[model samples]
Target: MKKIPVMAAALSAALLSVVMLTTFSGCAKKPKLYLYNWTYYTPDSVLRQFEKENNCEIIYDTFASNEELYAKLLSGGTGYDLVFPSGDYVSIMIKQNMLEKIDKSKLSNLVNIDPMVLQKATYDPKMEYSVPYYFGAAGIAVNTARVPQYEKSWSIFGRSDLQGKMTMLDDMREVLGDALVHLGYSVNTANPAEIAAARDLVNSAWKPNLIKFDAEAFGKGFADEDFWVVQGYAEVVYEEISEEQKKNTAFFIPPEGGPAYIDSMCLLKGAKNVDLAYKFIDFIHRPEIYAEFTDYFGFPATANIPARQLKKVTPYYQAEELTNVELKDDMGENLTLYDDAWLTIRVGD
Candidate 1:
């Protein structure tokens, strides 16, 4: 009788131990991801699809600007599995050691990315830490009907007649760089004298003619004909313009040159769910998903052959036209010169 009781107690204890182990294992297997990205950048349906297929919940967050996003990630100590940053910011983040080294072995769909984009990017020489998300050019959008006189050059922003009827980007680097390029200097010039000269040009131009120096509001102003000419992103203007207005609203690549930027996705260094992040990235790289993104976002994707085929079905695809688009190289420490020039332009002297 004593032996039987002891044997029964042991069996019960073993079963209890098994149950605990199984419960803990199940908890350990659930995957969760956190993503930080730009506002209105990704389609919610795509995110839903990812969640359904992977059985992982993705907490998506947005920032209005790259600088804001950088500041938050750097100072907040918030853990994000994935983030999207512009090409130049990627270089900055990598230098700060904030990004994780991507494991190519885990990313089978990485082959979908264009070799050219990977080769040309200055931030991730070998694309070690980031994947290209979108590419766009900065240019002038003018309402020809309002202006009557079409001006194609960058100098049009300085026209005296257009006083209080023009808007320029509030972005320090882009606006300053455009001014520098207008003066025939390198956009990435580090020479203090050169930057100062660029500042003078922009300051002198700002005087009574400037309507507002802004980024976000400028695009809407242009579309509404509140401004005759505005300096802004090509993609945003392209999407905002009505088919009728698009004919009258001309988009130009300044003869003097303008900024070209690439937005890319990167993994944070201390991310707890790195594997899940890679899985999510690979899922987006699939042809169908890429198509959906390009259709809604109206920017060029970096995926190579698949993107080419996907473009066929969507009006947003511009594969042939994208060939001529340029990309901004890392300006290195010269970025400070651009920022300083911007301040000088806005505040004078």
Candidate 2:
């Protein structure tokens, strides 16, 4: 057979290449819905199940604290679809117009959330901007094996005997709030004199015993026997300890009160997949589904009422201890006072 002319063959080849390119390009995957939240907030099994059921990819990222999460959202160009911010940050975000107002009707599983938690989310009082995820109080994690003499109290931080073996959270609010609690002042107090007095108490009482202020890995130090007592959230105690290590650990919320927080799932203004975001909120609220998260993380589920009935969850929330706990309020312009105070403490100035 005679070969086709060179020009004819070249034209055919170019057309074939175009067809192949179009076919492949049309099938290219789109960007996945992005979730920015606290480290270890979403369990591995929970994430895998959600992705499998939705038949969609989820891009997950983490920040260690609410302040970090807030700053990231404030920087803009985040393109995040969802974020888990505590109540106070939710309030701040709403004021800045960085969050998308949620359509309550879309949340079919809304009834699953405990009405009490919803009522307490003051940042979204109308329940129009966010949905409660998990709420817990900030407290102390004591390694009883290394230091058995301590009581279930915040006074552990002021114990001179534990000096160089104790750690307080690096979070300014938690440290300052504890100081406020110790001084018999409200954690949300904005009075200059009140804040000054609390600051002085922290500097004298907690500074000497504190080997370091660590929120990220104080648990590891506890496990390693480096820290005899450490300050952290109630959930952190459960998250970082192994079964063996747990035998020697005791978690406590001081008698006076501790800083309580409600972490809510908020929609970002840049969420490209609003419908799916709502679906996710509804999906995670199911009792059994929510139990998987609580059981794995070892904290009580606040928003999911049925989850509270689960054997694994019932033990975590002692209402008498946690019910009247103080939730951190959005300080707005008053945040500067906290920043300055934290800076001074960190520098020993």
Candidate 3:
């Protein structure tokens, strides 16, 4: 009977040891920062370093467009610590009270941002609620290997010979913005007539040649030679192609100009990891880190001034090329005008 009692005590001690180890392991798990950003925007190396230094895990999610981001937030998709939205949607979110005010006092690296980028961020010039990430524009990418002759202009979309071999972004603002600039109008115009004119141009001219309005797979389509010409972000198109193909690729913002955008990192309201979010934001602005980001994507350091000197790779397009490009502004209620016209274009010819 005494031996049985002794064995029971030993078993009890073993159980307690296992319980203690499990609890310790659970407590040792790292904290996580949830980030919602655009697809293809974040670099793995930069993220891994941040995670290692902070001893925290990063949970990143991606959205394809500003509308998708807005819709998700509007639908009560909470728990995200940070998000990346373009300048136009930044203004919209501010107006709707969907964001948290940034505490600049916590960001020592804030000084690294380029002043020119801040000036263009009229939506939040003070950066009270947002931090500018990258400023860029969509441009036409043509395969010089296939298309031997072409103009570096938006007008190329109208060439019947290139019909069914081209594709434009399905985004209303971007597509309309292209036509508006080509027609010598502002990209953010709320004028009913101007919006209609842009809509008509896309429907009557560009649409005839386009294989389809594509936003997601145009990069792959371009890479596979399924489409000879595509209008999209330089990074997106370049990401899908190899070095040899990139040599034959010509990416440029049209001379007549089109809409440009400044995508920003913002803290979402009710974020649980406020301190970690701020840390990540400041980390991103650090010269070396920002340079790493731009280099990974072959992007110009449009927002981080110091990072420009640190970048190792050549950008797909130069910053000066955006001189003629116009920033897209929040239309507020006037957006309905463009929406109505876009409806006709999408549903019609």
Candidate 4:
């Protein structure tokens, strides 16, 4: 009787082990690709398709600005396989040795990128460590129904009549860049006098007519009609309003041009999902996939050349309008010039 019970227990234990092994192996977790990107940047549909096709999950995190992204990475944030940073910050990150070398041979779809965009990507023209994702600029979005007679110029912010109803971005580089370009200076100029001029212009001429410098709620303020004129990204302001409101909204890159940026996708130095990162980068440059991304944001196909034809909707602004726009460059230690100027501007009148 004792031997029979012992044998039964052994058989049960063997069956349990096999069952546990089968359950654990069958339910193995899928590989994950971690991304740190701009808020509301990648479209859900595209992410879904990529996840399904690759049988993997994407873990996405967002940062509002390049400074925030850089600060986070520099402070030892890890596990992010890829990041989207503007051209200036890409140069900064490259110098900081926080990025991995991208394998160009794996990115077969890179030929589809616009030659012009490549030429303008002075930060990483050869794309040794980064790939251009989008090239765009922040523009003025005016509510035509409320302010119909305004000129399409950066000077519109200086109008006393539009005071209290106007706002500019809190971003030092962008606001100061607008002022710099308005005065015919290079956006990347490190000349102290020129930077000072830009600073004084904002503090005197522009700040007086503005309600407040805002980056976060300008879109919502525009949609609510609280702000009739807002200097911001076209897609951000457009996404907040109705189709009917869009008819009355005028988004323009001022004639003199302002700061333009090419936000690129870069691989982090210690990323574990190296192969997946390359696959994702190539997948993004595919004409159809690229078109979907631009269409989602109502953005011009400025980077991916062939994707322009594949776009389903009209872009908010034309690629040609970016003609005079200059890419903001890494200032190295010279970034301190803008920092001091911005501090004074932000302290208010």
Find the candidate with the highest TM-score and give its number.
4
User: What would the per-residue lDDT of candidate 2 be over residues 1-349, giving only the tens digit for each residue?
Assistant: 9899999999999999999999776546533678988898888898888888887778889988787887777776488888999899888888888889989889878788887776667667676888888877867778778787877667778889888999988888888988887788888888888888878888988898888898778877887888878787656666667879877877777778878889888999978988878878888897888888988766767678887777364433354566656888998789888888888899867
Deviation (Å) of 98 in candidate 1: 1.5
For model 3, what is the C-alpha lDDT against the true structure? 0.91
Which digits, one per residue and each the tens of the lDDT, describe model 4 over residues 118-170? 89999889999999999999999999999989898999988999999999998
TM-score of each: 0.82, 0.86, 0.90, 0.93
Q: What ranking emerges by TM-score with the best candidate at the front? A: 4, 3, 2, 1
lDDT of 1 by residue, 179-230 (tens): 7778887667788998888788778875458787878877778788788788
Least accurate stretch of 10 residues (summed lDDT) in model 3? 1-10
Off by over 4 Å in 1: 1-30, 148-151, 206-208, 238-243, 302-305, 312-335
- Per-residue error for 292 in candidate 4, Å, reads 0.7
Task: Evaluate model 1: give its lDDT.
Answer: 0.77
- Candidate 4 regions exceeding 4 Å error are 1-20, 26-29
